[model samples]
Target: MTGLDPELADATGKMLTQAVAEVVGDDPPVEVEESVVLGNAAEVLLERSCGAELLVVGSRGHGGFSGALLGSVGQHCVQHARCPVVVVRGSVS
Candidate 1:
């Protein structure tokens, strides 16, 4: 998974991990790394997808814009990711 913003990455990772645990009934090992792309989620996915089996990213991001469409990073990854990508949507419940 690509996480460009540290704060967003942390929060999302925690939520994802929790959801997985709830569904699977076990806490698996999950590593949330901070990519070097900083503010660019596309660049981070491009770099991380070299040998990755799947690319997972949020549909929206930590930007000021909020609408019904996907964010810039989500759009770019959908078009450019080497492998299959999963774009998770909705806010944490």
Candidate 2:
């Protein structure tokens, strides 16, 4: 996962775990590696896409609506990911 701020990465990971549990019932054991990429969203997505089975990301990030309006990382992944990409959007409830 790529986050401009390190603090946000922890929150993002928690949110992702919860969201995944909601859909998948129980969370599976999987290896998650976090990295810091200092670049644009497109660049980040490109770096991870190579040789990846699937690139998963949140639909809306820390920027919320502003990020949505500006085309989120999810959007960039959808367009550029070499393999299949899953974008998870949080629900109101």
Per-candidate Cα lDDT values, in order, are 0.67, 0.67
- The residue-by-residue lDDT of candidate 1 on 1-93, one tens digit each, is 353577877777788667666644654466434333445557878768777777777765455555535677777887888888887776756
What residue pairs are clashing in model 1? none
TM-score of each: 0.52, 0.53
lDDT per residue, candidate 2, 1-93, as tens digits? Answer: 443576777766678677567666654566454454557767777788898877777665445464563355667778878989877656656
lDDT of 2 at 51: 85
Best by TM-score: 2
Clashing pairs in 2: none
Global fold similarity of model 2 (TM-score): 0.53
- lDDT of the structure predicted as candidate 2: 0.67
